[model samples]
Target: MTDTPSKYLLNVDYGVGGVTTHFRSRPLGDDLHSETMVLNLGPAHPATHGTVRIVVELSGETILDADVEVGYLHRGFEKMCETVDYNQVMPYADRLNYVSPIINNVGWCLTVESLLGIE
Candidate 1:
């Protein structure tokens, strides 16, 4: 039996002839030793279905925390809109949701109409 310097003390058995050993940690800090891990899913991975990034924190195979990022597909969408006239911006809006572009087009129209106080 030996003690290792860690958050939890490890009990290890060194086999005879120094061939092999087995070890396990018994946490000294808390009654339940919950080790956490952080995972980055991606802005380019297929499962996400789009240019999005996810940050996940895990503890013992359970999710402890998560965060999401969107819009890696078109970073210039907003910037390009700013450089164009309102009517010209429709094309950019349509591209924002290419899968169902009519939704983006209608949403942009509603936003513009509301901003201009048009019925």
Candidate 2:
């Protein structure tokens, strides 16, 4: 329905298509239709400490489509901060990013300090 074929075909904003609408493979042959396979990368063990699900569709060696779903790392950060005292939130923010957690902790502390009119 959109200007791009893949957007309407794959439902992923001009990416790739699937089964009945595999535009690329259709041009390869008419007698044999290429079967698409879906591969799940992860909902855990991500490079960044958070959990993420990566879905990839493949037609042989070529990638037909893909989708990425992001998770919250089960921290419930906002709610947790709300229930705790202002000083208690520093530790939680420090754990947000493993590679450079101190940055997050400092940023969170500064934000809370600003809100309380503390220089």
Candidate 3:
């Protein structure tokens, strides 16, 4: 019934008494809206975003949100392990990370050990 710059966009009501709103978008100064930019980082190994990606939304120097998208980084690791005995699976789990062989292997062992409810 009343138009207040952002009158209805408030909890009072949608345009009932609050102002308009965008799910995103910030104020640049006093009267201008901040521009939003999306930066995609990671999953850069083969140029495919289907594995894992970090999406960052930036407004000036402020970060609105940073999301980690895991599409298929370890899609079939479990399935791959399913076909082999636990002893043979260390190598497959090793495939998870080559940069830190010991840590990755230890993590895999810990994960499997925990799953089996053992120490």
Q: Mind giving the per-residue lDDT tens digits that candidate 1 earns over 1-119?
A: 54653443342443246553222335666745567766788878878666788888778799988877776565588789888899998878877764788998999999989999999
- Residue-level lDDT of model 2, residues 22-54, one tens digit each, is 223334465356477667776775553567777
Q: Compute each candidate's TM-score over C-alphas.
A: 0.56, 0.58, 0.51
**lDDT for residue 38 in candidate 2, whole number 0-100:** 66
In model 3, residue pairs whose N, Cα or C atoms come closer than 3 Å (at least 3 residues apart or on different chains), thus clashing, are: 6-18, 6-19, 6-20, 7-17, 7-18, 7-19, 8-15, 8-16, 8-18, 9-18
For candidate 1, the per-residue lDDT at 77 reads 83
Q: State the RMSD for candidate 1.
A: 14.8
What is every candidate's alpha-carbon RMSD to the true fold? 14.8, 11.0, 11.5
Candidate 3 lDDT, tens digit per residue, 1-119? 54654434455544443664223554657635537777767766466534667777888889988877676365488888889988788887676665666887888788779989999
Candidate with best TM-score? 2
Identify the superior model by lDDT, candidate 1 or candidate 3.
Answer: 1
* Model 3 vs. true fold: TM: 0.51
Where model 1 places Cα greater than 4 Å from the true spot, the runs are 1-36, 72-74
Question: Count of backbone clashes for each model?
Answer: 0, 0, 10
- After superposition, the stretches of candidate 2 with alpha carbons farther than 4 Å from their true spots are 1-35, 46-49
Clashing pairs in 2: none
CA lDDT of every candidate: 0.74, 0.73, 0.69
Least accurate 10 contiguous residues by lDDT in model 1 = 6-15
Candidate 2 — what's its lDDT? 0.73
Candidate numbers, best TM-score first, in rank order: 2, 1, 3
